[model samples]
Target: MNEAVDEAGWDVEPGDEIEPLVQAVGKLLKVCREAAGLRVAELGEVLGYGEDMIRKMERGARIPRPEYLDRADQVLNAQGHLRAFMKDVERARYPRKVRELAELEGRAVEMLLYSHHNIHGLLQTPEYARALFEMHQPAYAPSEVERGVVARAARKSVFEREPAPTLSFVQEQVTLERPHGGKMVLRRQLEYLLEVGQLRNVVLQVMPTDREEHAGVQGLIEVLKFADGTAIGRSDGAFNGRPVSSPRDLRILELRYGMIRAQALTPRESLAFIERQLGEL
Candidate 1:
């Protein structure tokens, strides 16, 4: 097994201990640069990053983008060790929003999700995730895409958690039809969906375009129910574009998501529907 996978299973809590992981990579980078006898400005010039960005990365305040890591690896002749260290840094500093979801996911007894435009993050394969990120209309640099993909993929850890929370997703049918990553990638994505859907804890429902009234037209929402039966709902634009977790607000979102699920395919039927769509593709 990979060392990273082994560490991920060790119940590594997100806290002060992460500081050392961050610092180690930063220190390694600084040492490599000094050994190369290169100034920060000189290294930045070679990497095409601002000197400040380099400084922040070396200080462990910001995640070094993959391009920076790749260049550092090549320039410092560190072989693949630096690349491995960068992955550890990412596991430490996942985006705030992704981390929030991951924490909630860890505690939730169940989850209800609605995605209108894109595949729900949990269901994405690496290639599909990359294709989705690359489509960022303005286009992301390769490093940006790698960071987003790793963060997104890492969120799937929820599926492997003990007593995994039940997941019910109401995704628009159009999302599957758009073909974001071309035929083969979409095929693999659909296959991955099938594999995940078979997990006892998951429920996936596809919202058809023919629906007369769409509950998700308002946008994406995620509702989580904890062991206490307490629930929280997060909407895309609610709370100034933050997740809405107040009991009252969560109740409202839950009601709406429930309505959306009712309007979509049933879990068993949804699986067949997705398989049929895959066949058509």
Candidate 2:
């Protein structure tokens, strides 16, 4: 395999302060291209991307699309490097908490999600995502909002993957009823939810506002189960509201989600519930 080194060369020196994830795939791509004795223009010719795109890929300025990555992997004869790199890039696209969640998501055979304050990130449409970002308490610059919007939008692709993981989501009734980004945007968001809920891999449940003892009262929790039967759970704690994740913590959260699912309407009934909520709009 062709190898390259950091600025310090192959010498064992100080670690990379920039974080290996920053330019990891980029460096790998550069090395892979060089090893194949292919120029940027030559590689671009095969991928139908511009040399500039290839340059950005090597510079870490852009993350390659899965299709592009797959094709490049085949063309470069790099085994599965490009495909693996895409998964890494997808994880790196989000905040540390989000990245951790995404890593867990990829390994997960099933996910249990609860959202009370807003739509679950994975379920949000672009317009809805934009609205949520724009409504940030401290406010975000347009560029920052765009970045967040894209990151959240990209997470939706998990559902499209082969052997997709099972997703079970419960949202508070009020969240669905509250309109964000006006009527048209809310309508589109609801429509997207309805359409996505029909997927065989997805199960959406709605928790009624009048539920006597809502399990989600503890807060939003996401529990992910792996094929090995190992599970991780995350929740927002007090203080800074930083996320908490651990197998033990997840067990507690999983029980709570189980209760919430029991309390809420069934998936079929929830679909009807969402339809009724949408009709109110």
Candidate 3:
């Protein structure tokens, strides 16, 4: 067991506190496997994972992906117990801040965004996200970069929710041109933007660099409106740069976002512009 633990990368002391939810999931996996009379190695073979990985997952030293829970539920005949824990497992994979943001995003009924720099997180490709995290000022470790990439990709789940949220984005032309992760990465990103733009619930516009009068010159702005009539906003132009939820502040941000959307190229035109960029690439 000690050798297996070391192989699974459990660098912490034995008494370290594991996340409660993760521990709960591990217990559930163990109970189900035992109840089904399946040994760890047998279950690992059934799931196409190594015995050490299964043991680590059972010990709460590692988090399993959602699909893993589904398969475990089937193989262990735990009915829906394992599958029911998928949401908790998924949440445990992300950092605290990302989990909070994703919660807010999940509850949002609508999102309005103006990006003067990089593409919005929800719109970024995995390669693009990995590259961006790798280029962080202090430089992220490989594991940190992978985690960031997964977290960002997880935010796209909003697009898959029932009665999908209304999303509107205005991206600066210069942002599309700047190869943050080099030309090929940018090309795939632009292509992805075009794909996401075509979704019925999404409105994507491009703020042309040639425009002299830009409403969003102040900087990136994001407004998320919830189903309960409350909203939250953040912007580079805001005095303290903190997220604001006051109705007055939300209204002010909405007004600016509205103007930016109006001034930018229409969705159809934006798609054409992106296509042109792809051709140039």
Taking all chains together, the TM-score of candidate 1 against the true structure is: 0.73
Residues 1-281 of candidate 1: C-alpha lDDT, one tens digit per residue = 22221112111234555666666777888888888889988986776666766676677655564556776889877777688776665556565566667777779889988999888998989999999889898998666686678878888888998977889988898887778789988888888888988999888889999989877777898888899978777777566556666777887788888899999999888889889989998
Which is the leading candidate under TM-score?
Answer: 3
Model 2: which ten-residue window has the lowest total lDDT? 3-12
Greater lDDT among 1 and 3 belongs to 3
Sort all candidates by TM-score, best to worst.
3, 1, 2
What are the Cα lDDT values of the candidates? 0.77, 0.75, 0.85
Off-target runs (Cα >4 Å) in candidate 3 are 1-18, 27-84
Q: Estimate each model's TM-score.
A: 0.73, 0.68, 0.78
Which ten residues in a row are the worst by lDDT in model 1? 2-11
RMSD of 1: 7.5
- In candidate 3, how many Å is residue 97 off? 1.6
Task: Give the clash total for candidate 1.
Answer: 0
User: Model 2 lDDT vs. the true structure?
Assistant: 0.75
Query: What's the CA RMSD of model 3 in angstroms?
Result: 4.6
Show pairs that collide, candidate 3: none
Candidate numbers sorted by lDDT from highest down: 3, 1, 2
lDDT digits (tens) for residues 139-249 of candidate 3: 876666777898999999999999899999999998899898899999999989988999999999999998888889789899999998898999999857789999888
